[model samples]
Target: MTEARSNIAPVLRYAAMRRIRSFEERVGELFLRGQSAGSMLHLSIGEEAVVGMTDAMAPGDTFTTHHRGHGVFLARGADPARMMAEIAGKESGYCRGKGGSMHIADRALGHLGANAIVGGGIPHVVGAGLTYRNRRSGQISVAFFGDGAMSQGILYESMNMAALWHLPVIFCCINNQYGMGTRVDRSAGKLGFGGRAEAFGLIAAHAEGQEVEAVHHAARDLVAAARDGRPGFLEIDAYRFYGHARMDKSPYRSPEEEAEGRARDPLTTARARLAAEGLADAADLDRIDAAAAVEMDAALEADVAAAPPGLPTMFQDVYAPGTPAPRPQADRLRAVLSEAPR
Candidate 1:
């Protein structure tokens, strides 16, 4: 592993970390203030490194994420104001406020979207890879999912297709031990999620997701391999500091488990590494944090001031052009007779 260089620019790394943390903190505040209405809100508090490392890869690479994906979006250069507006149901949001915490999409930044369904986005990423391969675009598509997604059949199917076609796809499994309320040992027949990829004939690599530098190295190599028309899998052993969802107290795991995970907070670990290696000083990190705080605060204010979508939008974006509109109950009988009797 390469030591942190003193001259290396930590701007992107610090930005990713601060954005994720700020987003999560804002979500909590929004929920408390009754501005956000959702049954669950999964916060990626300690798992910032996974996406931070990804930010170091190709700029045009595409990524699809699971419900717990604030980190991925921020690392991919998603606009904080837009994301806030979306979560607040404002028209300026990525989905025009239709997609809340679980479904944010920004194609311009190569973020296909984040899906609420556990393994729903895996096949989408494969399709993206296929599109890139067909066009010879040299673009790589990535799928970010939790450990629970490994059990889903779609994950296996997607992996099979990517391997068979040699598409440029990277399967990133953020194995945080617990899937909702169930622990990995209790749910997974095979605890090794990376090994499952190898069974489908895909190159698999495992890394400590808690370490930013380690994830950066692993993701960098996998991305390079994928760009060469080789599909690969990366299993990142990380943990979420909070519950699976906002409402979950995580009774499945004890308090001790949560504490142990918190001790290895990825953001803190990254900062410590930089400082210990003389790559950055305390002053630099404090400045980065302060700047991020200001940015997030301004974003929240903008999101609150934006307008919500109107009622007419409900019928839009639902069907293709020239598609016939549904007939009313009273008109349906007359239309049927006019067509059939004629």
Candidate 2:
């Protein structure tokens, strides 16, 4: 039992790191290979600690993720095969390939979903918390968003409501230094992201998001408070190694900025911490890496052989049960008629 318990953290950390690295790298390659389609990809490199922190939370606890959510979904135990298939636009994806990288969901795992619209998932997580409270359930809901999302009004509104209602919610802000081309300093008036939560009377904590142990400890404490019916906030000071999206040249940031960010790679930091603390040896970490590589390779191969969804099934899941079919011609005429005003 002691050995099993000791090995769990290292394995989980390695898996989260591996999945994020492999998924992002492969997605980029696939995009360059002309196999991927949709909105530009925002790879979450150098910020694996946030996902590692989520791995320590309760299994039933739910969370809403941002555009850079592949790590979160994997840390929450989402199947890599399906996730890769989804990114590859295969039929076996989480949303039957309809929702790609930014919109993956696994209801059973309590991943409500990841949203492409910045700050879109904030209110949804609040709704989930309200559902838990109304049902008298003990589960906690988490909202994960980037520092740029701090500018949005819905985030503040959600915080106000969560604090007032004493909802079991945790708002995790991954302050990755920039929101697209704009730096945090350029966009947010307050430099400290966590302090922004205090106005709503929510208990907030900030930590070194590049360090897995630090992030895990902070998350565990906040999640404990949340489960006790207190809303909390955590601001993880992390960085992303990639641009906001594939099309972005990141001209706003310099080579020096990228170098500074790369120096604190989360995967390396986590492995070193585990070794220094005697929780795991280098060999154990290597074995985990090897296993992760194998899994990722298999997933990629399967994704390559997969086919896109059929065109006939495009509108299959658009409506609720017994809803009438949408009339395109009538809708177009109604728009013209309404504009003409009789």
Candidate 3:
């Protein structure tokens, strides 16, 4: 798929944001309809500009994501139908129904994986960056985590290692404010996440996730620096318009707060920006949104109808090739009974 690249042409960026917004909305609907694999869907509805980072990245750059990675993967060229299938736990999904929404990954797309652990995936990019540096490949790696991970010691360690080794890696913090039910301000005493990166001698930038163009520009420069063996950090601060998970209604947050957060909708902001700039008129923007909606609607239907992985294949990918597969628990029980009778 063609990309927005360094400049992030306004029309293409708007279209990509539209697709992510539509796809996320469809995911929410899927959960509501009880078609999702689990009750653990984390939507990236309001944080569409985080996907803009993909626009700055070139082919072969690798990335790892936190739980709310659906938008990023989609922007990086994941098939929406397959993504929905994965979220639905269907056989045709990216991980063959094994990895649902939070864990979906495609190595072919340079996505190492989406990890559920707070800062679990950050270190992997450091290792990848080390490999790239040793090979002089000029390729970079990225670790996409959340503000919650700001408190994780592993993140600091990983950042230090990346800087110390002069590895080409980027630590991208998608700071959507809330960590679970708690607000970020309530947790971290010292803010300015970018300031912490400076202590480690890494280039860092912060951008509002609502501004698609601004995010793309920040990411583009960071990508260039990372390719040149300068590890960097980017904090895309946005607001989470929903709860931590699909099941969470977030009683902790007042209705007014949610309203205020929703008002900062990145898609709405980008659409108006595009129109105001004459990059896309209302009709063109509507067409883009309509196309996205159609694409996701079809994807939803396909995923809803897609078959689940057969029970017999449960352990298919669990072990090394040629390793003895574990017998079904029922079969094991029967064998034990037979031996006892003898």
Best by TM-score: 3
Model 1 TM-score relative to the real fold: 0.91
Off by over 4 Å in 3: 1-8, 339-341
Q: Where does candidate 1 have its weakest 10-residue lDDT segment?
A: 1-10
Best by lDDT: 3
lDDT of each: 0.82, 0.82, 0.90
- Model 1, runs deviating above 4 Å: 1-5, 321-342
Please provide TM-scores, in order, for all candidate models, with all chains considered together.
0.91, 0.91, 0.95
Model 2, 88-147: lDDT tens digits are 678988888888888888899999999989999998888988998999788999988889
Estimate, for each residue in 1-342, the C-alpha lDDT of model 3 and write its tens digit.
123223337778888888988898899999999999989899987888886688899899999999999989999999999999999999999999998988999999999999899999999999999899999998999999899999999999999999999999999999999899989989899997999999998999999888978888999999999999999999998999889998899999999999988888788888788766666677877888899999999999999999999988797878887998877899999889988955
Per-residue lDDT of 1-342 in model 1, one digit per residue for the tens? 124554564545755787789878887776667666465578888788776457655878888999998888888888888988888777888998788879999988998989999999999989999899999998999999989898899999999999999999999998888788888899987777778889888889888867877787788888888888888999888888888877777877788888998888877877887788777767777787888888888887787778989966755666765796544566788878889954
lDDT of candidate 2 at residue 295, scale 0 to 100: 80
Model 2, position 238: C-alpha lDDT score = 90
> Could you report the Cα RMSD, in angstroms, for every candidate shown?
3.8, 4.2, 2.8
RMSD from true fold, candidate 2: 4.2
TM-score attained by model 3: 0.95
